[model samples]
Target: MATVTTLAPQAPQAATRAALRTALRVGWFAAAVFWTVLAVREGVHHGWPAATAALLFALAPDLALFVGLSEAPRTARGQLPPRAVPYYNAAHRALVPLALLAVHALAPLTWPPVLAALCGWLAHISYDRAFGYGPRTKEGFQRG
Candidate 1:
């Protein structure tokens, strides 16, 4: 009788990485829920203008898609346009809206609609992160 042997799979690292990725996604999802609740609360407290602002700001970042639709050349179909990469990245960063919120906290005046907008923006970014969407590379492709 002949005996055959096979090498062990080297999937531990891969498994670990996948687990971490899942944990990160869950964290982002939790943040999304928190921010969404806050946004809704702000809009409810402040009325129609704030609600409208929140709704608009939530969808604003995605408007970057329109840039890809323009005449600018792309590396592939459905890829973001190079011209729009900067705009999309900037809008998607959680830090921008966070900084705005911090500024709002410190500034002398109160703007309810702006606060609502910031909350909406944070919710949008958090949801994107949760779904594994993020800033694209300069080449207009998803970064690894």
Candidate 2:
């Protein structure tokens, strides 16, 4: 009797960077879905103005970050350098959450709007944390 020999499939090793990136992607996607659902629900129950306000405020930080990153310095190859630019970008991300928290503390916001903003901020934190992008992390923001 002849027996067939088969090679066992190998399990992929987890790389810290890749795992972090994947987590960030998943968190961002979840945040987007959550935002859409909250917006729709608020619009249906409350009104367009309230929903619009929530959506806009929730997205403000992300928009600001995008603009800031766009104008950030780049290397000769037209790519953001790994060290300075990335640190700057991470600082930019950290600022969004801090700004949101400040607004929440200083200004009075209705529960729905406040909740929406908080959720958005949490999403941003998750994205940053996943990619090792925060003040405490090695690759993230740091005090000078």
Candidate 3:
């Protein structure tokens, strides 16, 4: 005889997944708000260049994940191999942008390209956090 089943009874693992998804959503929203406010404030003070720079810098890094993963080896389960996680995470982590922002703030770098690039990096990283994209775990899973 055939058996019938339904999604009505979610497994324990499903609950965990759901919880993680909710947490990630909340985090993403908060990050987005923070970055948006910061970007707006900076744009107000620094002019359009700040926003433009940030958008450019923020997008470039995420591209690395797409580009990097294409080259990374996949596991039997079709997941990213653990070895490749850090490299993906490094590109996505906000630390780089955070540091750049700090350096720029503490002492205004006079080099136009560098300063703008840093600002852009800040914008990108912050937005990445907001967009529910966090760093990769050693298991090759996303922190988000």
Candidate 1, residues 82-137: lDDT per residue as tens digits? 88899899989999999999999999998899999999999999999999998899
Name model 2 segments beyond 4 Å from true: 1-20, 63-111, 116-144
lDDT digits (tens) for residues 55-143 of candidate 3: 67656765555544554655444345666666657766667767866776787445344455555555566556656556766766655
**Best by the TM-score measure:** 1
Q: Tell me the whole-model lDDT of each prediction, alpha carbons only.
A: 0.89, 0.52, 0.62
Instruction: Compute the lDDT of residue 139 as modeled in candidate 2.
Output: 31
Better of 2 and 3 by lDDT: 3
The model with the greatest lDDT is: 1
Once fitted onto the true fold, the runs of candidate 1 whose alpha carbons sit more than 4 angstroms away are 1-9, 72-75
lDDT of 2 by residue, 6-98 (tens): 976544444665676677767766765665565566655666665666566555544433433543554333333334444445444645655
lDDT of 3 at 97: 64
The worst-scoring run of ten residues by lDDT in candidate 3 lies at: 108-117
Clash count per candidate: 0, 0, 3
